[model samples]
Target: MAAIHMRMLGYLVTLAMHGGNMLVMNSLLQGPVMEDPNIRTFSAMYKRFFTVWTMFLQLFVASLGLTTDYYTLKYRNKKEPQWLGVMRSVKNRIFAAVLWPTVFLVSSLFWSLYHYDRSLIYPLFADKILSSTANHILHTAVIPLVVWEVIFQPRSVPKKHGVNVTMLTVYMFAYLFLMYYTYIEQGIWMYPIFGLAYNKHICFPLIISAIGVMLFIYYHMQWFLTRIVWGSQVKIKK
Candidate 1:
């Protein structure tokens, strides 16, 4: 009972956190930042951002967590249904395969570039649009929240972990394609770093390779953390 209660509470917290983030983002769209012609133009391409993509993923996983919990609690005294089992499996897979890795990657890359030289990734002008609170919610808070989910949530390591990694690879490459497409269309790089790259031929591939390596490391780190928290064989409650 206590375990179930804790899981449900965690789901609720995750939902509220991401829901609040969505609200913050929505306000930014309607806020004074849109008044700036540059910001207004950039906002049109906001969906192309990895941060926005990850935020949507987080929101989705949180919703799945809550729905799974609701059914789990409702059927506590009875045998679990097949649909509930499927829901649990889907939620677990998404959390491990997509949500965890992306959040880790975005947070690490954003902060690394932000600190190294904010102008490279996020410029001074961006601060006007992304307030400190929104910025932290988008980049900083996500890391701990994902870590918390890993520690608290029981997830089985997928039998075919390669599939998960492949999915991530596809996503990264798709985004890379989008970056080039945007540049070709708009005559500008999606990120300022691309503009400063002396050799696009060399730098772009290196960038993608570095991201691939990071995702690989994060996947293994998640696998290790799951083993530590839930033992070698994680027993998912159906």
Candidate 2:
């Protein structure tokens, strides 16, 4: 009973934090940031970035988690409804397979490149427009929040790990396609690192392949951590 209550509290807290971050991001998009000609030009493409997409995914997973918890509490004495069970399954799969890995990848890559050369990832001028609070929430805070979810919320190990890998592969390629499409249309690479490639034909594939490998490693690392924390026999509520 205490564990159940704690999980509920975790869900509520995550939902509130992500919800607040979303509000901050939205305000930045709609507020005075748009007054800058450079920012205004890229506003439409903002949602196309992986960071924005993962943030939405985090917000969604938190929202679904809270809803599932609410219904579970309300129906504690009754048999779980089919809809609730389905919702729980979807939330778990998405959180485990997609959101967790993406958050880690985005945070790791952003901080690494930002430190190496802000020009490659985030330029100095961006600081003039985007708030420090918003930057940390988007890039830094997500790491801890997702880690908290994994540590506290027990999720069933997928019977077939290939399914998760396949989903991740599709997501990676889809984003790769979007990035290339943006370059074709805008005549600029979304990230300056791509522009630095002497031969994009060779370098881009290598970079993407490296990212794919990292994401695969991240997936297995997450699975191993889940098992370590929850044990191999962690059961899911039907």
Candidate 3:
């Protein structure tokens, strides 16, 4: 109970910050959704928009953490319940063991690209579009919060956690395909890196290769997390 209490603080903070962004995004009266040309890049386009990985994964951990912790408390000290099944729904072994760690990588890659060339990832005129609170909480805050989760709540890894690496790769490829398909459907490129128009022959392979590199990075991250926390790789038999 004490251990969970300590960790819950980390999760609560993360939830508040993430949910704050959600609130801002959907504030209705003061919401980010009002049609303003200044923030059009920030708010518009579901799949054909700019990098959405941060928003997707941020919401994922917040929702998953909340739900999982809810169940953990509900079923605490009780007989075997549906918690394991709940975990399986999120494929949480890989989540705690791999995907969560990748948040750092993704964050790094995003901001790095943004910093290197703002318009390459995010445009320049829209620099001050999001309030600093919104920008910092959504973009910068994940680092400390995720690191806190990693240090405090190093959950168990399944014996077959390799599936996570594969799933993540599939997700990346799926997103890539979606981006291309969306361009065909709507005739626009989401990120500035793709420029106003792109040559698929050159960019597609590069994008595919980048996804592969990200997956490979996750494999090593799995090894590093497994070794550091559990002191060895522990895989549960499927």
Candidate 4:
């Protein structure tokens, strides 16, 4: 079971990284393919490129989470499973399923709020490519998914593992740098907080706020993982 969860998570992280990288490259090359009335530019090249790449990425990620869920149920009471007691109920499973995307949304919102005046993160995601209403709904729904994954997903359950706040901090730095590259290359903004750099002195504060959000989310997620994965256990009496 540990092996299975590990493989699934490895695949999920791989898809996210690969998809993000490809999307960044696409953005850099394409520079925001806005559907303008004057320009009929929904070419075969564009469709095919996104189609195959996105399909594989989405498939692997979805499969990882679903497969993890399946394994959890199959070996719920089996000893020697690394993910034992992680999902004690249907609610726990559901939350685990939704966690990643929910984290993305909440983290984005927190960053946006802290850097409210900056507007660097605001401009990129402002335009609704899929229509404003649908986009808004999509954004709102993603938060729950992210939260669930954090709260319930089974991990290796390492007790007494050294909590390195430094590593978490470094990850946020790398994520932001890559995010900027993603925005520049893909010509689309993943977070609105990247939209505000209107030649103002707001960059430093916004970046700081974004980092804070990342830290908060990271520690919170770590705590959640510790609580459900390592801290809690159900013992069977003979």
Candidate 5:
């Protein structure tokens, strides 16, 4: 647990050291990658709007999660069960019912916008580190942290574990396959980090490490909720 937290902290520090830019400049560098529709030109369209939308939307969800957590716990009776046993309909209905659809819609929006016709409006990051780092900071680290807050809130622990585990697993695999398609189509990589070896071999480790970190956090969060906030409850037979 300590190691996992340390690793996350290390990532934050490294990102800060990079002057905190998360956006990589999207130079139309001549190579095999120019073929990608996402980066083919700087035309203005829904693509740009979608990028902004995704970043802000992620931020909003994260904020909402934190605010929700604060208010719920503020009024909640710590002595009483926040949730019933697995058999309870309300908890499952309230949490599970909208979770999948909401996630799928949001993720789909990103995938679609990423590939939309006028997609290549701006370079992900500008050439200068100090200049583009702020964008990168906002785009990568900040946005994910927001999503993390939403996924790891104490009252939402069970739903958070189930949803994040399922969604993140699916997303990682789907992105793996999509990356191959991207490489084939553009002859380049999706993330700059993957372009390290002129291929993605070095990048796989980063993805794996991120997943491990997420799982560790998930477990710790679940523990905090179960043992402290939610407490144990009796299962009612259906």
Candidate 6:
């Protein structure tokens, strides 16, 4: 738990700085960019890196894990073994077991995609808003840190895959709603793939369906990564 907490704290600082850099570029450097009538919704608060919402979600879950582990450790009474036994409960595994996949997968995919063709996934204009350091922080460095956590941390995955998938699906649904709302209000889409020109009829559903499939696949893949990195050091029980 200490290792996880430390990793989360480091990530918190890295991601926060990355975000701050993006905001400064968007507001101060590219002043007229936000004032454009077509995309003027919440111009002052617009984050240049907002299109990639998964990064934000990863930051959120990392913060949540740090907070949970901090208070649990702070409040732990080692004098009583009975109180310590509760650490293995399902509730305690939610952060590592359920949400870790999102961070690892997003980190892997974004870095790979950026390397393969920055222009295809992220256009030339995006370079003005995001720097190499910020890109590496969110996309490259995160992969190893999270993978290390998975390898080292002993976690109990949810007993029911259906439950985990359902929760993620609901989250994706809400995220999509926010994505569309932002587009309607400000005329800018966070992700290029979410652009209405992609296919108004099927793109949204396709994105959600793809996420559902990815979650299903990674739900098992995480345990495999854990097993390989840890060998017999740790075991995950459903």
TM-score of each: 0.89, 0.89, 0.76, 0.44, 0.37, 0.66
Relative to the true structure, candidate 2 reaches a TM of: 0.89
Point out where model 2 deviates above 4 Å.
29-35, 232-238
What ranges in model 1 sit over 4 Å off? 232-238
**How accurate locally is residue 171 in candidate 2, as Cα lDDT from 0 to 100?**
84
User: Which digits, one per residue and each the tens of the lDDT, describe model 3 over residues 63-161?
Assistant: 676666667777779864765566645735545544554565556666887778767766664444456676666567777766565556645545575
Count clashing residue pairs per candidate: 0, 0, 4, 30, 13, 1
lDDT of 3: 0.60
How much does candidate 4 score in TM-score? Answer: 0.44
lDDT for position 212 in model 1: 84
Query: lDDT tens digits, residues 63-110, model 4?
Result: 555565567657768753654344334333322332342345344654
Better of 1 and 6 by TM-score: 1
Candidate 5 residues 1-238, lDDT tens each? 4333433443344334333222333332346554555534322222223233334444343334334434445545754344423223332332232332233333433344445721322345322222434444433444344333333333333434575456545544555566556667756555433455344576567755654465445434434534443343312211
| Cand. 6 Cα-lDDT | 0.57
Worst 10-residue lDDT window for candidate 6 reads 42-51
lDDT by residue for model 1 over 114-148, one digit each (tens)? Answer: 89998888977677677788798889888877777
Model 2 clashing residue pairs (backbone)? none
* Segments in model 4 whose C-alpha atoms lie over 4 Å from true places: 1-62, 71-128, 136-138, 150-171, 180-198, 221-238
Q: Residue-wise lDDT of candidate 6 within 1-238, one digit each (tens)? A: 4665665565566457556755754564456555554344334334433334555655565555555555567666744344334543433355444555666556655666577865435666555555777666656765565665565455544456666666666665676677678778867676555675346867777866776677667767876775676655445322
